[model samples]
Target: MENREESRLTSAELANLWRLYITENLMYQFKTPLIDNCQDPDIRSAIEFSRAISEHYIVSIENIFRNENYPVPTAYSENDIHPQAPALFTDVFCLHFIHQGAQLGMSKIHEMMAVAVRQDVWEVLNQGANDFKDLYQQSLQLLLTKGLYSRPAFLPPEKESRFAENKHYVSGWLGNQRPLNALEIMSIHNTIIQNGISKAILRAFAQVINDKKLRDYLEKGAETASDIMRELEDWLIMENTNVTATLDSEILPTETPPYSDKLMMMLIANVGVGSLGVYGNALSTVFRRDLGLKFMHLMKDAVQYAQEGLHLVIDKGWMEVPPQFPDINTR
Candidate 1:
């Protein structure tokens, strides 16, 4: 079934297209409702832009698939969006969601562009990356203007360049431990902020979702986020720094869901994987033994939760199979 055409899509190109197509579908499903219910002009504009970006990617990728004669995977449909539903999140919280989405989009674009080889495929993904970059900048500026953006804790100017002088810098488990360095502090602060936002999203989803099992699972995910945030907060408090704001007070009492349980579970799974990545990255940056151990524990819990969500996605048949190599066993 391999295409003999000179411009035929490579397996990597097909995989990237498929992955982003699924993501764009989720974007459409999530953003349409947000756009309809969004009250803040600034937030609405950003959501519109974000939604447009996804829509553009979807159309562009589908064209590539069409030209290549590969059947596009079935993704979310219009039925997935509930625009008439009451606002599940406040304007400020919605803005936060878009901002975080932009950040994650940029990260994903980098991953996608890395493996893309086809000229046409790389062009499309590169353009998508630039679009996300612009969206990230715009959303960030809007968040800052509205005073909703949480800036990382500032460190004092370094008086001089220095390097770790002792083995204790690598392992602080024994003897006298040094205060947390800027790198360690930055990791803790960033992780706590991410967990806070994730908790808010999970809390809102849990409140509106009807399926008892999914709702219960979403609540559990929120609790896990809260636990991790509390531990991170303690570390920040030890440094006498204030923690970032949580959006719990901002979530509305809307009993109706803006998205279906299936969509919600998919979002949960996506965010769970991102959370695990953040923890994994932080583990590498943390210098203290205790801090590294803490990240490991949090990562373990996040992985377990993500696996549960993925299993549900599979059981419900929401998990789309990605492009794969031909099976030699059958051959």
Candidate 2:
């Protein structure tokens, strides 16, 4: 027990904490202003709750690093954001953002706990998971109350047990194909939702940033998101489905920059990672041949957009180095 208490951090625990620290910092930047400008009391309450927890997590992680005699990550701070800036997103958008963030927070918590070895790390992850779960529930309930929840395409119940008796079950590029399964529809639903947010973010960033080159890149991301969303919507339309999501109008008319360009670029780069994972999962799980091809194409575009953002981040000298192993002349 004594030895365990004094042990160094495991690789998984260290990596998870590092990623969470930076992501949470970015979130804090967005939440700080949203919470201040939010008009809906219910939405504001939930955002406030989430922001408080994020602040606690940040300080807790800093203490953990200090105890380990290691340097705490220099993540975002006040300099990276202007909490008093003009409104950039509506209160409804704030609610949706918090809802989405809570979902991501839960995902991170699961990964954090799965590989956590130390008892202290487990405590933090466990508590964080429970808190995020609560936040998720709270935000979802608020969305439902406000009639803002974007549900996936509804699938009818199976009338009887069935089996795929032929190869045509997997075919999608030909005539008279099988209807989409719940999983496939759900995947499309999520992709549309993400594209909605990503496109809006790119548009917002493009409006505020002055760099012509990066603005063009941001516009490309927005266009890619829009194109993919339209294709996915067309697929859903064949099945008599329509998904209503975040609108471009949900963004305010403010031309002022709320977050630094570095933060905006980082957010886009993170979207690239999230998009690849979402598309990859859809590719593997979706049964239709056409859907698989569609994800592959969308994944290619996502990769290209992300690559551009990464190059910009590197060129701007905004990319920070993570802890690395010493070069042992690996020749």
Candidate 2 wrongly placed segments (more than 4 Å)? 2-6
TM-score of each: 0.94, 0.95
Q: Which 10-residue span in candidate 1 carries the lowest summed lDDT?
A: 1-10
Best by lDDT: 1
Which residue pairs overlap in candidate 1's backbone?
Answer: none
Q: What residue runs in model 1 are displaced by over 4 Å at the alpha carbon?
A: 1-6, 327-331
Give the count of colliding residue pairs in each prediction. 0, 0
In lDDT terms, how accurate is model 2?
Answer: 0.83
lDDT of 1: 0.84
Task: Supply candidate 2's per-residue lDDT for 212.
Answer: 86
Best-performing candidate as measured by TM-score? 2
